[model samples]
Target: MNDLSRGLAYTFATGLLWGGVGVFYSKGTEKKESFYGFMFLSALLFFLLTWIFAFPQGAPVREVLLVAALMFPAGLSGQLGFWTMKKALEHGPHGIGWCIVQSSMICPFLAGVLFFGDSPSAGRIAGMSLIAASLLPLSAQGVPAVREDSCSGRFLLLIFAAFLLVGLQQTLSLVPSQCPTLSAAALSWRVPLVSLVGLGWLGPVLFRKTGVRCGEIGWISLLYALLVFLGQLGIYRAIDFLGKARSSGTAYPAACGMSILFFFVYCFFKRRERLSRRALAGIGLSMAGMFLLAIS
Candidate 1:
């Protein structure tokens, strides 16, 4: 397959993996799992799986530590944003609440254009526009889930914060690729660093016995972590093939759009999720947007 096809394939897998994360997270919620504890544990899993091979050879300790330190803050910002998104879901309205998490993607796309020297084409622009616009139905959801007869300040703040942080996360994820030494060891250097921070955050929870048992959702969390690892791999590869701007403009949104379709099928058809016609229309628009993106 060509670069575009491979990139598209990787991007599609990225979406399914991300959707897997939501599935496990939903399971954790059902089990009343501690959010911080679960996330830390999952990050540890990703770290171990990715870095275990590199360590058996006894690589340079100082260099390894340096790489880990660089990635820590970037990963932490994303971790915090992820938790904040969960809070938004719990306290705020449904459509707009979740919409913010997905919509924060605009930051990376904008960054690509402004800083990364990415030039947008008509198809790319229109495709991204549709993908973003598809979420309007949810963002406009006012009555049942939201309070104050409108989208609340807290919810909007959480969304904006999440957008900035996740966008930063995406931008930082590209750092390793920009350096030749780190590029070849992208996952080796990056996952360990992020996981180091996760372990530190989880240390107290584990040592102090926070009463957050991972027994039931433990397998699911592991699955989620693996999917996350794979998704990151896919994103890096997609960026290699398409550049940051095209990767963000086409691949990231395409995966998100596909993931939404997967949820719509499972929730609306099989599980009887409370999906409205308007939401269904929005999902269809997103899928169409993905098609446009792929061929653009």
Candidate 2:
């Protein structure tokens, strides 16, 4: 396949895999399963896989240290983001929570412009505006009349926390790729290092006597780890094929947009998540914003 085709294929696969991740997360929440335990297991499994297959060889000490420094915060932010997202999903509408999480591409986009000297355009500005506007209706959807005030407030706070933490994680993940001194070999080890760091954060929970057994969710956690690993692999390959700048502009939006669509479909069919008129309008605006961001 041509480079563009390869990039598109990888992007599409990443979207599908990430969409599956969200679906599984929602399922685990619905079942009142130990999502943290599942995450801990998945992180261990992911680390093992990356160590075996993607570990770098003979990398410079400085570059390895750089990857460690960046990925430490990235891993911590990612775990914190997952925690908030789990809370948000448990209390709020599935579509709304997932949509906000997927829309976090805006964070890195803005970071690129503000910190990395990426030029912003009119379309991107408008796109960001629409995304911001969409949150109004999305937040409203989370605050139905049947729910208590405290519950509503908690849900909104969790949602906002998820958005910020996930965005920060994504922004941090982008930095290693942008660094000019890092080689592909040096960067290859980042996946394993990040997974290792995530395991550190989950260590207390995983080591507790009352912790959920791996056998309880073994197959599911395995699937989750596989999906996450493959999704990251797809993202890296897409960037390689399309280049950092082009991939940042195109691949991220395509993956996120497709994941949102997939989540909506899953919610509609399986969870019976019917959207209010306002929610539908918000989704429309968010999709339009993603499109504009992609082209900009």
Candidate 3:
């Protein structure tokens, strides 16, 4: 298949995998303890396994520590956002939850410009416009009523925060590609592992133990870890085939958009949430903005 086709295919597959993530996270809520507990344990195990292969033979302790340190922020933000997202999903409409959670992308883009001096282009401008267009309606008025027990206002904040974290993660993406000495996989694993371990240390001291004891929860966590790993693999593969432009612009968002749409459709069909006329408009605009952002 051609580069475009391969990128498109990867995007679609990524969406499907993410769709499964929503379902899995929702199921996880039924378990007993806090979402972070499960996240921590699962992350720890995954990191342990990844480290076994990821740590180079006889690598310097200092270098290993440095890689681990890099992971701290990424993992903490991600897991925290995830826990918040899961809670929100349980109480909110799945479609809406997914849609809002992605607002995290905006922050990183802005950060890129500020920190890395990455300038925007016409396509980037148009794509960002589209994404912004999609959000206008959603934010114009009050959202549809969410469950009292669900994520609601706090959850929305978490989603926004999560997107920012994702943006930072994106900026960090330059490290591996630019450095060339550290492989992407090694960087990827280290980043997350650091964050998780940091959170595992901090979570309990700050808050009550939110441990969930459900056996099924373990399964969901495993699936989440695996999907994330696979998604990263797909990203690299797309980059190899399509280069950065296609991979970042068309490929990543296309996949993410489809994933977002899938949740929206599922929520609509299930009658879990009503898509306001405003939301529809916002979604369109958001897509435009995303396209603009990517190409820019």
Candidate 4:
């Protein structure tokens, strides 16, 4: 296949893997499996993958340290984002949590424009506006009357927190790219180091008294790790191809948009989750916004 085809294929694969992550997380929560166990195994597997495949060869010590420093906050934010995402999914409608987190592309896009000297075009502005508008309808969707006041409020807060944390993680991911001293390979291996450090925080939680069984979540954790590794690889390859063609903008929004669509369909059919009219309208707007963002 040509470069464009390869890039698009990788992008779509990444989207599918990401959507699968959400699906598996939702399933795990339903089973009352420990998020800590899942995250720990996933981080460990990701670290092993980096050690085997992406480790930098004889890089200068200073450069290695610099990369580690840059990745630290990114890792922390990503871990926390995942935590909030799990909590949000546990309490709210599956589609709502997934959609809000996917919409976090806006965070990195704005960061690029304001901090990295990217052009702020009309298309991008309008796309951001549409995405912002969609949030109102999404948030307005009614919850079950049983716990409407408490559960609904908490769910919204958690999802919004997940969005910001994930967005910050994406924004931080951009920083390593701008560093002249860091090679892509060097940047890659250090990713798992920071991830391990982030996962370390949950180690204490794992030791706490809980009914969560490792046996129950073992396969789920392994699957989560495998999907994450493949997704990260797909994203790296997609960017390499698309960047050369000067169409890298298509990769992020395309993957995110596709993942959101995947979740909507998967939840509707597999879980029999029906969205209200306003929520459906919000999703439509969000998709349109992503399309505009991709083109911009």
Candidate 5:
């Protein structure tokens, strides 16, 4: 349809892909299927596919080379983030990890405003404050009110780190300003982050935990990879079809909303994670900020 509609659709789709990551890991039907393993493989596939599809029409050779070279960082980030995320999943409930990681959205929003000169509205600012406020209770350093196991502060820290990287990845979206024509430049800024997921292998390697079967895991990882590839492509297409402002306005907020919705429904029903008044308020506040940011 129109640019705004397209942007909104793409952004929402990205969130759906991102939010479903945990679901994919959960559906592995085997404890041996580590989230890190899935994340690492998925990211590698996504990046490779991105390169293939992006360059098929005779993209700039120099830019592609540079983009490929820069992919190292995105890979690195992904590896680390995935490790943290996987650990969080193992240590915490399914959807709670998603909520925790999302707590760091402020990082990118700030960066966007500072580096990209994207101004947030007053409503957005207030919503952000509420989001930050909502998180205060979670910082108390105790086992979450309800869970399979006690969530340690260490896990919280890891989740926060994940959030930071996600934010950084979003900020990396600004890399195109320096090298706009090179599709690689835009994608490269985040490739290392995805690559960081490889670090998860350390667990299986070091701890001697039984790893996922090669054949069984391949298809799952491939699906994840393909979804991620299409999601990023959609985002890039949104940026192309709709200018950054309108695109971000529609997409970012919609993505957050969708992810949050998934988290709430799944955590309450499937995983049965306990939700406190504070957590609900936080979710609301964060969503409000996201909506404001979109309109802003």
Candidate 6:
């Protein structure tokens, strides 16, 4: 297959893995599992795997290391996005959380144009406009995802935070992308470092949570880490194969839309959650926006 096709395929598979994360991780959280602890374990496992399979190979790599330093904030931003995402999942359905987090496509597109001197096409403009417009309907959800008496504002804020934080994280990667030297090893080092930082905050929670045996939770967290790595690897490969423009502006957001599609179907078939009509409409609107973004 050609670069574009391979990129799109990888991107879509990434979305599938991400879509499943809602099911697996959310179920773990539902079992009264500690979110931080679970994340810590997953992060630890991911770090180890990266170190074993993708450890830094060059010596005195000052430039790449400097770029890696800049990439550190991207890791932090991702963790923040992850924290809000879990909380949002607690407040709403899996699809809602996915929608908010996936909507982070805007920042990358802006970074491409503003910093990289990339030209924006009319189709991209329209696609982005539709994406922005779709967020309104989601915020307009009448019923809260988690609670009957709870204010929808809380969930809405969670969604907004998820959108902003993850967007920032993705945009930060654009910096590394511009530097060919850094682009390849950027996340290889950054992900493990992020996992280490995650341990600092999430470690205590792992120790304190009741009945939280590491042995029992090992498989679940391992699965989470594997999924995380798969999704990240796919996106990274897509960017490398297809260039930052299509990967970010089109494949990235479009993959997110695919994720929401799987999530909506999962929720419907499993009958795990009650999805309102407006929520369905919001999802559909988001899908339309992604389609435009893709074809553009």
Identify the superior model by TM-score, candidate 4 or candidate 5. 4
- Models sorted by TM-score, best on top: 2, 6, 4, 1, 5, 3
**Best candidate (score: TM-score):** 2
What TM-score do all the candidates reach, one by one? 0.81, 0.85, 0.69, 0.82, 0.74, 0.83
Q: Per-residue CA lDDT of candidate 6, range 203-290, in tens?
A: 5564675534577677888898888777766766665555654444455666666776676677667745556777677777777776
lDDT of each: 0.65, 0.73, 0.55, 0.69, 0.56, 0.67
Query: How close is each model in CA RMSD to the real structure?
Result: 3.7, 2.9, 4.8, 3.3, 4.5, 3.1
Q: Report how far off residue 29 is in candidate 3 (Å).
A: 3.5
lDDT of 5 at 278: 63
Instruction: Give the lowest summed-lDDT range of ten residues in model 2.
Output: 142-151
Off by over 4 Å in 1: 53-70, 93-96, 142-152, 178-183, 186-188, 203-209, 244-249, 269-271
User: Tens digits of per-residue lDDT for model 4 on 161-212?
Assistant: 9999988876676665555567766656454556466456356456764433
Query: What would the TM-score be for candidate 6 when compared with the true structure?
Result: 0.83
Best by lDDT: 2
Can you write out model 5's per-residue Cα lDDT over 1-296, one digit (the tens) per residue? Answer: 76666666677677777666555655542345454455455656765776566544444667655654545454455456655676666666555666666655566556545655555667666656665665554333212454535377767777778877765554454344334566634444343333344545556544655554556578887876776666666655554443444224334444655566565666667766666766666666656655654554
State the lDDT of candidate 3 residue by residue for 56-135, as single tens digits.
Answer: 34445555555565556555555566666665565555556666665545554454345544445667656755764565
Candidate 4 ranges with C-alpha deviation above 4 Å: 1-9, 142-151, 210-214, 237-251
Q: How far out, in Å, is residue 294 in model 1? A: 1.1
Model 5 lDDT-worst window of ten: 137-146
Off by over 4 Å in 2: 1-9, 31-33, 142-151, 206-208, 239-243, 246-253
Candidate 4 structure lDDT: 0.69
**Candidate 1 structure quality by residue, lDDT tens digits, 271-291:** 445666677677777877888
Off by over 4 Å in 5: 1-5, 26-30, 33-56, 65-71, 130-149, 177-219, 239-243, 246-254
